[model samples]
Target: MKRLRRVDRTQFQKLTYPHLEFLYNMALKYCGNTYDAEDVLQETMYRAYRNFHQLRDEAKCKPWLFAILRTTFLREQRSLKKRPLLDDGSGYLKHVVDQDRKSLGALLEEKMDKANVQQLLEMMPEKHKSPLILYYMEDMTYREIADLLDIPIGTVMSRLARAKKQMKKNLLKKLGMHKKKRNFSIISVFLPGGGL
Candidate 1:
């Protein structure tokens, strides 16, 4: 491992250390559990520390760190040869939704609580869920999400659109089966007109 100099250490701490909580939350979402998330976080931090000097623009630290985290998680996933389990159903989306309140519209925010939104996110496929989580939860731009996920910008936008559509369908289906379906007029929340 490379030893960080005094200035390097200070720079790293200032630029990267503050994002620890963001890393943890994202790792938890990606790994879908605390233990694996911690492992991913540990590896990510270590890698970041070693590579801190290579970062050209300190302003891009978040996306750089996210790329490391995402890459490490994928490597770990491949080595383990098992898909991550969505074991925690207890309001993960709540934290994500709350993290970026400005991105959502007022009406959508009013209609959707943390739990249902979390359920909507959790139920989406990993391909779609990954981008949605980055875009909405982390409030990353489409280009940043594309860089981190290593997909094209067009693909990122397409996936997000598809994810929202899928979420609306799932939410509507779930609500329609319930007695409170009549009271819930929240399908537009996931639709394009409300917000992205």
Candidate 2:
């Protein structure tokens, strides 16, 4: 019994120790926060430790770990008692905008002057943005993205279509094309002795 436990421990350490940081970063990108990603990583590692025997091939370790992490995150999100609204309270807004400006300078120079589309991308919902990012940013094939997200290929296509539409709307509004209407109520006060 002790020998089996020792072998399991060795395998877990050998499989996960080197890839922990990579897995954490990937999880963080999906989870969109440091603390949540950290928790997800920990839970994923724990599960991997318990289910180490289920891994069929050691060569498929990276994808397997990522799948576990992704599943763990999704499960946590579903089980939340009250999901909190996404906000830019952690200075991530500034950081993301700055990085976008620096990295996309060529696009800015060619297309327009100083357009921060990346920050706008950050404001988009995870469901919409995830497929788009995985498709365009990461250069993954639709099939690969579908596999990674555990969704049908058609669903991935639909989500990408809807996501592009939303992105267009958001960009237009941000550029001041579709201004939001403001409602104002005016009250009149009548003074003694009306004008003669």
Candidate 3:
């Protein structure tokens, strides 16, 4: 059996270290807590270190690292499914709505804060959320999202459409607004610069 060559420590660090913060942020989006995000980041770094030799292009490092981190997060989630339930569902932007429908209209008049936006984001399933995160939040192209998710461009488009519709429906329902088939204006207006 052919053994892999030892990686140069400095070389790996130089290439991969710059993206730790991005990876952690992405991890936070996926894991929803600092502790779990840290864990995912550590695991992602480990996997990247181990597979650094496989990287053929330096420009693709960020995307490749993101893919590793995403895979690690998914594996952790799947493993948790086999275990007992311990989550209280209280961590990571968990919001409890108690306002009546009448007051909810007032909320629609105002801008959405980060927590409310994040709460809406958390309500969606991962398969749907991933595309949104990649396309909108990360500003990646649909082709790039499809490549990262290993899905077809058409599937990415469909999932993005469905995800947007679901978010609009959820937001309108939550805020007690009329459920019009309009664009999710808040997300488009607030997401990029409003610091989601």
Candidate 4:
């Protein structure tokens, strides 16, 4: 690996290091384990360090690093010849809880707590889950997701839409059954203007 220049090291440590947690979380979501995610993160940093000189725009560092990380993880998965890891239910549930805790309070978290959502999401093919995770978890725009995934923006939007619909259907089925047993009414409110 080429040694990072003082300025490059400073910039990476200052700007990129802060995002390590975000990267790790995304990696964990992708790989479905802390160990694999850490491996991917470490490999990503190593690749980033080696190829830092090739990065043309400093402002694109975040997305660029993520792309590299995704590529590396995919390559690693292929090498291992293991089935693509799915959400283990617990990990994704913890992630959802953590996200809810961060953005919404515990009360809202309780209301939003649907363990089946994670399992349903995991059941989705990577084509759907990847874009959904990138768009929702990484807060990436469709265009950004396209760039990272090396696909067109329309594809990302379409896959996201389908993924969301599938998730909703699965959640509804699971919750409906649960409510039926408990003798509770399940009401679904669709916004007048929302499509998909």
Any runs in candidate 2 off by more than 4 Å, and if so which?
81-196
For candidate 2, the TM-score is 0.43
lDDT of the structure predicted as candidate 4: 0.67
**Residues 97-133 of candidate 1: C-alpha lDDT, one tens digit per residue:** 2323344333344456777777777789999989877
| Consecutive 10-residue window with the lowest summed lDDT within model 4 | 185-194
Assess each prediction's global lDDT (C-alpha) against the native.
0.75, 0.68, 0.72, 0.67
Question: What C-alpha lDDT, on a 0 to 100 scale, does residue 181 get in candidate 1?
Answer: 34
Question: Once superposed on the true structure, which residue ranges of model 4 sit more than 4 Å away at CA?
Answer: 1-4, 82-196
Superposition error at 46 for model 3 (Å): 0.7
Query: Distance (Å) between predicted and true CA of 110, model 3?
Result: 21
Q: Model 3 — which ten-residue stretch has the worst lDDT? A: 97-106
Better of 2 and 4 by TM-score: 2
Report the Cα lDDT for residue 93, model 1. 28
Per-residue lDDT of 1-196 in model 3, one digit per residue for the tens?
1232434667788889999889988897676446788999999999998898899999999999999999999999998766654545675442232222122212322356667767887899999888876776566788999899899999998997787677766676777764655555554422322112
- C-alpha RMSD by candidate, in order: 18.3, 21.4, 18.0, 19.0
Q: List, residue by residue over 26-91, the lDDT tens digit for candidate 2.
A: 877676446778999999999998888889999998888989998998899797635544468884
Full candidate order by lDDT, most accurate first: 1, 3, 2, 4
